[model samples]
Target: MTPEEITRTSTTYNLQSWSKQKGLNPIPVKGGEGIYFWDHSGKKYADMSSQLVNLNLGHGNRAIIDAIKDQAEKYCYISPSYGSEPRAELAKMLVELMPDNIGKVFFTNAGADANENAIKMARMYTGRYKVFSRYRSYHGSTFGAGNLTGEPRRYPLEPGIPGFVKFFDPYIYREPIEFASEEAASAYYVAKLREQVCYEGSDKVAAIVMETITGSNGIIIPPKGYLEGVRKICDDYGIMMICDEVMAGFGRTGKMFGFQNWNIKPDLVSFAKGVTCGYVQLGGVAVSKKIAAFFDDNVLSCGLTYSGHPLACAAGIACVKYYTEHKVLDNVNKVGKTLGEILEAMKKKHECVGDVRYIGLFAAVELVKNRKTKEPLVPYGKDPDGVMKGLVGKLAQKGFMTYSHENMILVAPPLIITEEQLREEMKKLDEVLGEVKA
Candidate 1:
């Protein structure tokens, strides 16, 4: 459908920031319930990517909707400086839910703001100016947050801030070596970081930020022992350890936080999206007691007008209740395993499917020009041919919906997704792949 043909007022303004070469279709979504959303055209499609990989809980969650509505009716926006019941309740609730020792919380409107605040906190607490992040990672799009982003997406907004250093992340599929085992690859990455710290001076660095499981650039899962090694390294150097769980948090990996898989503790963890199952805008950094102490009458130079908004907190409280009461996380574990097996089985059959990296419900099917070489199907967002370019569009046309980015497709659905529904999406994907089955 042409953009001019459809005219309707959206509750919120839409951002026109997309690759003009590849025009945005801008379909108008009318209703969403469960994993499927119906566009204004009266057609329903799966939210396989969960709307920017947020919405860890699917749509039409009446419980969350009711909580938001109820909270809005009772009390809406309040200044961040003041105390609110839902705000305090969510803060305590999140602290309990996080790993012990992570006893502090600073809320934000989304992941970007959370990261910005975390950086500020780290710099303040450590009294250092430098922060490290791995290439092929995205923290957010805000000036400070986007500067911390290591991926090419950050290129447009360069010279972001001083002390922003980018480094390499361990990607096994495209390892620097001819070939290396997972253990060897991980060790190599650790050594690289160690060398970097020596050159950059760990004393000058405030924190080493990285995604537990790399999200947007590619679903690159760190090799076993990788995160633990980093945690130890950070401990040794007195550098604050930070994990960007913006994508991996909230049962996306079948655990409350993706870092749990590695069994390592971080000084601070930034989270959003799944905390409220995308019911409302909410994000925050789970700070340790050490950082929290800095807030004691220090005139903490960080806050948002909508920080800890009551409505978002209400959504978060209800979403957490849903996860705890209904075993949504357990469902993620079961469905995640089931999904992995099917995907691996498909990997063997499809040559374009080079690598299948997953952690629970969070999964990525890396598309490649050749399975042996593992060449990317497209360069970041530039896909000229319709083979890989039209995959999501084709899936939509086939009565299913998913997301594709930079030669990989994120198959993350809501944690509440059922095995039966999952298979249906997979089945549709199988058919869609046939059309571009290179």
Candidate 2:
């Protein structure tokens, strides 16, 4: 179909997520290759946010495409009860890729359900009810995962599930306290968390869930000893540590998983996005040996119709192979360093840039009306004037596609992106930032 026809059909017949239905003129993507995708009108866009930070291997990956095709030719569907070759292989690959403590996998269709199953497993295994997650985090939007979420997006799920609890992140930039060092800040936050757990009755808390690097909510990297402190707290009590790696897994952070960057071993790790690089939807929870052993006699209550789907597993296997074969982590480290440098420079050059936080290719550029006071470009939980939207639109006009959350702009590009391509794409961001009025 022509671009106009495609847009018309989609706008008329389809419902877009997180948006009003009317006046929707969505782009008609014809094709994509490497770090770029083009519309039907031949306007190419650099996928700066990696299309919601999931397209890690980037567009038109032949290996992933061919793997999906191969699986389709053999067989497309298989019940999870029956063992399938691709499913078994991918599960083994995932186990091997995860930390030593992680011993088994429970597959799901996407991150939301992966998290949902993880929560159930945590509750069952610990025989406790309450689950704690930070206020700045985004797990997913499904009912359970939405409650697991702590941001404004979770408001629709109000009067939420009883056991889900919220806490503050170590968002030092916005924090009122002036700490002597990161260690001091970590101590303060960790102490507060432990105290909160005590007040809530630690024995009743099933798990302490956290995004290893806090994606979408400003990429708020934890200060030194914060994760270790959390780990210790989880150990002190029998509470499980669940790291949501949906947005930070698979070499996005120049490590296999985001938790690895902090050298912490979470009891349950929920992952998706990069495993299949959006080639096919797949997500899973990697449970530690202890959690796996818990289900030896007790019944594992979680089930999904599409769990361990063979085609998605096939795509996952090829995607994992491509990561190692192509030295994707090496590229992430190399280009990510360049990205950090560019973001730092932009922070210095742009008056609106209040802070720039990054790890590997994952990064956020926060906008503020006043750098001294750090007044956000838009108010918290309210973007009534569409200020952030307008700024993102400016970036889009320059062919640099990314999304904004509140006052921050996410800058995550595909893991396979080259340094030259990164520099070029980031130049567009630099230009757009230059245009923004403080």
Which is the leading candidate under TM-score? 2
Q: Candidate 1, clashing residue pairs?
A: none
Q: Can you give the TM-score per candidate against the true fold?
A: 0.95, 0.99
**What's the C-alpha lDDT at position 34 in model 2?**
91
Q: Per-residue alpha-carbon lDDT of model 2 for 1-438, expressed as tens digits?
A: 878899999998899998878776788999999989999878999999999899999999999999999999999999999989998998889889888988999999999999999999999999999999999999999999999999999999999999889999999998999999999999999999999999999999999999999999999999999999999999999999999999999999999799889868999999999999999999999999999999999999999899999889999999999999999999999999999999999989999999999999999999999999999999998899888888889888889999999999999999999999998888888888888888
lDDT of 1 by residue, 1-438 (tens): 333454322213344554553345567778899888887768888888888888878989999999999999988988987889999998998898888878788899999999999889988888898999988898999898899898777888976688888889888778748545777777888988988987898899999999888887778899977888888788898899999999998888888888888788899999988888778889999998877877785767887888898999999999888888888889999999999998898788787888888879888888887877777888655777755657877777876667777888778887888999999889887776655544
lDDT of 1 at 121: 90
Clashing pairs in 2: none
- Tell me the lDDT of model 2 at 209: 94
Error of 1 at 141 (Å): 0.6
